[model samples]
Target: MEYEAIIGLETHIQLNTSSKIFCSCKADSWFDGPNTNICPVCTGMPGVLPVLNKAVVEKGALLAAAMNADLQPVSYFDRKNYFYPDLPKGYQISQYDRPLAKGGWLEVPLDGYQRRVGIWKLHLEEDAGKTKNENGQRMIDFNRCGVPLVEMVTGPDLRSADEAAAYLIRLRQLLRWIGVSEADMEKGHLRCDANVSVRLKGSETFNTKTEIKNVNSIEAVRAAINKEIERQVREYERGGKIEAWTLEWDEDTQTLKKMRSKETEADYRYFREPDLLPVHLTEAWKSAILADLPELPLARKARFIGEYGLPEYDADLLTAERSLSDYFESAVKAYGGDPKRVSNWLLNDVMRMLNESGKIAGELSLTPAYLAEIIKLVDAGTVNTNTGKALLDKVNESGKSPAQLVESEGLAKVSDAGAIRAVVEQVIAESPAEVESYRAGKVGLMGWFVGQVMKKLQGKADAQKARELFEELLK
Candidate 1:
């Protein structure tokens, strides 16, 4: 029987708040050494209390609203009892029965269709510490303890490994676009645990699923999910029952190793936390939080296509980042020309500069206004196309106005008919054989003669006028 894969993701997004969720310790300790950013509250010392960070709540609510989840006016934190080496508190402070939000969906645009991945639940939580095994000894670092995280669980809506990867890519884009998290999978800003199951095609009954962990990248998630699906399919072929297992992805081997059996929700003795009160988001507070939401990635992409007539490919790329999309629109409006022209310059010229300088679109020295000025100069025949393209570099490097660079450097197009005709006459005189070949029906040589004139003029000659001169003088 043909099988279909069902995938759900439990993603832990590290918020970019200034402080940890329940303490004054630093939120991001990625640059710091282990245990350097820790304190008694995060380490769970005896008789210590955690003061909830207000910023965490606001950011979490903003994300929940972006996902279209239903927010709870009053959501309480619970103590998830688990004894792990990395969990110093012996119980993790998380939301259990009553989470902050529930039931939202992300529209992931795949190759040819869109997949709506539903959000099962979203809750605020404090992260556990890190553990590593080395030289037959286990080492623990508490620096990550108490770090603010929004645990978002997605419904089992993905049908294939590609869909799971696409959902993750879209989620990462949304997170950064909304300024919630860096969402860098390699740096652990966004982490995912995929629960994967497969069933016979046309069957609605869900089979036993396996949880795969330690996939640090989207490509790894895709590979691990595909591997697990194949394993379950093989089991079905053998007429054996599949067991729910927790597997770890070995990056070096690109394989999954059985870690243990999957744990049910009952395994963790979850209870309401005694230290903190329930989160009560008043109408005004919710409004204030939602007010911070900007036009999301997909929405802006659609607008780019509809409002500006950008092709879907161009729109998708331009909206990959919020700042870049803002830059594109700003440039378009400033140029006052066809939007596609600005799109091409941005995608090709501006993007190359950004990549080389390790800067984003907004950080460019060549501002949108300056880019528009250059394009206008090109449009009005003040500068040749090559000169206009070179002005991008000159303006960026010198941080001067494009018009100023054109004036100071004598870069304006040689559109004067007398000047171009003189150069074209000189080029034809210097190349008699080529000129004869051109008159004898080697019409392609016309471009070469124009090239020689442009070369002599230092690329300042009006190409169209030179082409006209070549046609007239050659005949």
Candidate 2:
């Protein structure tokens, strides 16, 4: 029998607040020395009480609004009783029964259709410290302790590994676009725990599921879920019992190793924390956040397709990053040329440069006005497509405008028919054998003749005009 995989994700996002959730210590402790950012409140010292950061709550509300989640006017923190070397308090402060948001859905594109994945809830919590084991000694850094986090739990609405990956990518884009979190998987700003199960394709009852913890990257999330699904299916087929467990992904081995038994909700022993008061968001405050919400990725993508006349694929790519979409708009506004042409240049030349330089669109030396000029030149046949691309390299290296570089370097299209015909005549005169072959019905040599003329002109010729001149001169 064919089996279908049921996948749910619990994603933890580190908020970008200036201070820790319940303390005034700096929140960005990723690169600091061990425990430098720690204080009495985060380190769980005796008699030190925790206080909520108003900024965290406001950012959480912004995220909820972006996700279309219902923001609960009242929510409170709970003590999730657990013991780990990194957790200084021996219990994490988190939200339990009354989370900050609930009942939202994210729309992801899958198999040429839009699928809405249900968001079970979003709760605020504090991050644990970092634990390092070196040479048989264990070290714990409390710098990350009390760092603000929002855990977004999704329903078991995803069916396959691809769908889960797609949902995650879209979610990250939304988070970044809304400015709530950087959601950079590499830096631990966003992390995922995937719960996966498999049953017969038509069966509705869920099977025993295992949780894959701390799959940091999107590629790893996809691979880990697929591997877990396969393992469960094979075990069930062999008449072996599938038990719920927690596993960790070993990237070097490309395998999942069993960590421990999965913990149920009761295992945490959650209870309301008496130290912190309930967070009550006023309607006026929520309205203010809602009004400040920027255009989300999906909405921007739709607008790109509708207003810019871009294809769905192009719109999807252009709007994948907020900076890239902004760049596209700026170039179009400055050039006032075909938006599709601007998109093609960005998706091809600009993206290639970004990848090679390991820089984001906003960090590139190529300004929007310069890129607009390049597009305008290509559109006006001042330079052919090939010359235009070459100009991008010069602009990046010298920080010169496209027009200045093109003029100084003589990269302009050789559109003068008189000058182009002279090069065509020289090419034909030098290649007598090829011209004879062409006249003898080897018409495919026409392309060869055009290449020779373009080479003679140093790729500065309008290719179409050169090709026409080649045909005329050869006959």
Report the number of the highest-lDDT candidate.
1
Write down the TM-score for model 2.
0.91
Worst 10 residues of 1 by lDDT: 261-270
Instruction: Give Cα-based local distance difference scores for all models.
Output: 0.93, 0.90
After superposition on all CA atoms, what RMSD does each candidate show versus the true structure? 1.6, 2.5
Model 2: residues >4 Å from true position, as ranges? 263-269, 431-442
Model 2 C-alpha lDDT per residue in residues 304-341, reported as the tens digit of each score: 99999999999999999898899889988998878998
Report the lDDT of model 1 for residue 390.
96
For each predicted model, how many residue pairs clash, with residues at least 3 apart or on different chains? 0, 0
Pick out the ten consecutive residues of candidate 2 with the lowest summed lDDT: 261-270
Give me the displacement of residue 344 in model 2, in angstroms.
1.9
- Candidate 2 residue 224 Cα shift, in angstroms, is 2.5
TM-scores, all models, native as reference: 0.96, 0.91
